[model samples]
Target: MNLRKATLTDYGVPPDDIPALQSHFRHLDENDKYNLLQVSIKYAPGIETQIYDSIVNCIGYRTMERFRDMPVSENDFYGYKRKTMAEYYHLAKLTGRL
Candidate 1:
């Protein structure tokens, strides 16, 4: 699902921690990056549960929208991945979080 920016900073990660976070993010391979995104978003203001469900393979997209939980709609949505590596990098550069 395409939502707002979800960089470390966008998730309310503090500025002091961002450099280290980005440095950590930089070294991760694809699988690790995917895992990192999952863990990283766990306590974000919103979108946490959705990301968690994707990781656990527990809930379906329709369930979230049907229950009026996540703000996603079927039209603008993809299957599971909430954010892409490209997206993360883009937002990081945009916000100077990279």
Candidate 2:
């Protein structure tokens, strides 16, 4: 299994830390989740692909349920076009994510 790591400079979060994000998201209120999604609606700059890879690495460290069952609602990132964040969100939504 390959491990990738990178800082989402825009959000100040390492994309490889999905587990922590999941745990924290679970404890947050609806508004807080929305705010977090809003804040994470973008990536740093030129590392979108690395961010995606890191997210995949992060997901590999956990069960599929953990990624799929994030506290985010279906409409959370509805219209956001953030590449890195989008990669993570869409991967979580994809059927049979590995």
Candidate 3:
């Protein structure tokens, strides 16, 4: 398996670590997810492809049940739908839909 390392440049931020972004997102309130998504989409632009790949690399493939389940009822800030933001990114890559 190949591993992909992410940096602030990947997310259009000045910081040098993607793990810190992951940790922050993990603990952030659910409502903040959209705001975070918007910022990511705006600043990172094409970073979605890489973000999807990185999430899959980190979490492995999500179970079908977990993948399809909707954890967030809100329309995606990125206009994609899935169990969670990570799952959206993962599925997008898996299906070549991103």
Candidate achieving the largest TM-score: 1
Report how far off residue 87 is in candidate 1 (Å). 9.5
lDDT of 1 by residue, 1-98 (tens): 23443443454556676565546554655655565465436433355556545434445567767765676554323322334333454555565645
Candidate 3: tens digits of C-alpha lDDT, residues 10-98: 43443433355455445554445444455446433554433343333343333322554434222231232122343433433354433
- Once model 1 is optimally superposed onto the true structure by TM-score, how far is the C-alpha of residue 17 displaced, in angstroms? 30
Model 1 weakest 10-residue run by lDDT: 76-85
Clashing pairs in 1: none
Kindly list the per-residue Cα lDDT of model 2 for residues 1-98, writing each as its tens digit: 11122233333345665555555434555554444344344542333333333343443212433544333222222112233443444443342221
In model 1, which regions exceed 4 Å deviation? 1-45, 75-98
Better of 2 and 3 by lDDT: 3
- Candidate 2 residue runs with Cα over 4 Å from true position: 1-4, 7-22, 44-98
By TM-score: ranked, best first: 1, 3, 2
Question: In lDDT terms, how accurate is model 3?
Answer: 0.38
Predicted model with the maximum lDDT: 1
